[model samples]
Target: MKKKTFVLVVIALVSVGFSAMGQRVDRTNFKAGIHGGVPFGDISDHSNFELGLDVGYHIALSELIDTGLTTGFMNAFINNDSVDAGPVTVEGDFPNIQYVPVAAVFRLYPTYDFKLGADVGYAVGINDGNTGGGYLRPIIGVNVSGNTELNISYVKVSDDYDFSMAALGILFLF
Candidate 1:
């Protein structure tokens, strides 16, 4: 009975020690990655592809879990000619709009080379061309190495058209 009590005491002490050091552990746990990929969607009839770039930082929340902040840039192309102006074909320039997406991200690393996660955030449209409203993105990726990953995701935007985009890219983690 005494032996059992001693073991329990040791386990309790160890658990307390770990919890106390949790902050320290997180303080030293950090990661970053850069990814760029071609996004595909119905933004334009002849757009073909668009460029995307993402840079983010990760804070280790647990052994297999992490939470952090992410910001990304997307050069979105869309065909404006679809909006036919009555009788005349309006020759309006189709500008590539820049999109900046910022979010609070959470990740779950299931394997050494794989991670699955989701992010909730907003996509702010740059330039006066188009102002997209709020956005929600669900992300999935595979880590190529300790500091690199490839990701694919779907982003839903709050707009009159309710636009959505599919993003695919590779990120270099730092």
Candidate 2:
């Protein structure tokens, strides 16, 4: 089922990754990105906005590909506070939903200015009642300047329920 699909995809990506190892290797670079998003799925009931910061170190696997490791913090701002318990009115408070993601990055360039990628890993929940989740983010990026890229992605974190978001981000590579 889902687990099998995940494993298959990972295997495919790794095979593709190894193919590029024989080509070229660029200097290791660091990247930082800022992202703003709209949360949906189960998280939408509690949060409306998501803000994230991503930092990574990467080296080109080939002229057309790059592989790296990325880690980031993402916070989903809580908007819901209280809920009704049948005839009783209940007032409660919960902290904002937050996750720290440690992931692997893979990017393929079709041209100098455009690329496609995905980050796959675990999102460790830092808020109450939440443990962690499997994380996946597929992205489309365009080079906006010398070392800057503008990207859009869909982020999904799956635990007991799915936490999904759509985000727009800007990345600076150095």
Q: How many backbone clashes does candidate 2 have?
A: 0
lDDT of 2 by residue, 84-155 (tens): 446976678978878998777898999989999999877888889887777899999999998999999999
Q: How close is candidate 1 to the true structure, as a TM-score?
A: 0.70
TM-score of 2: 0.83
- Which tens-of-lDDT digit does each residue in 26-116 have in candidate 1? 4433344443334443354435455666766566667777666667776756545444445856566667756787666667889767778
The list of candidate 2 runs beyond 4 A from truth reads: 1-25, 83-90
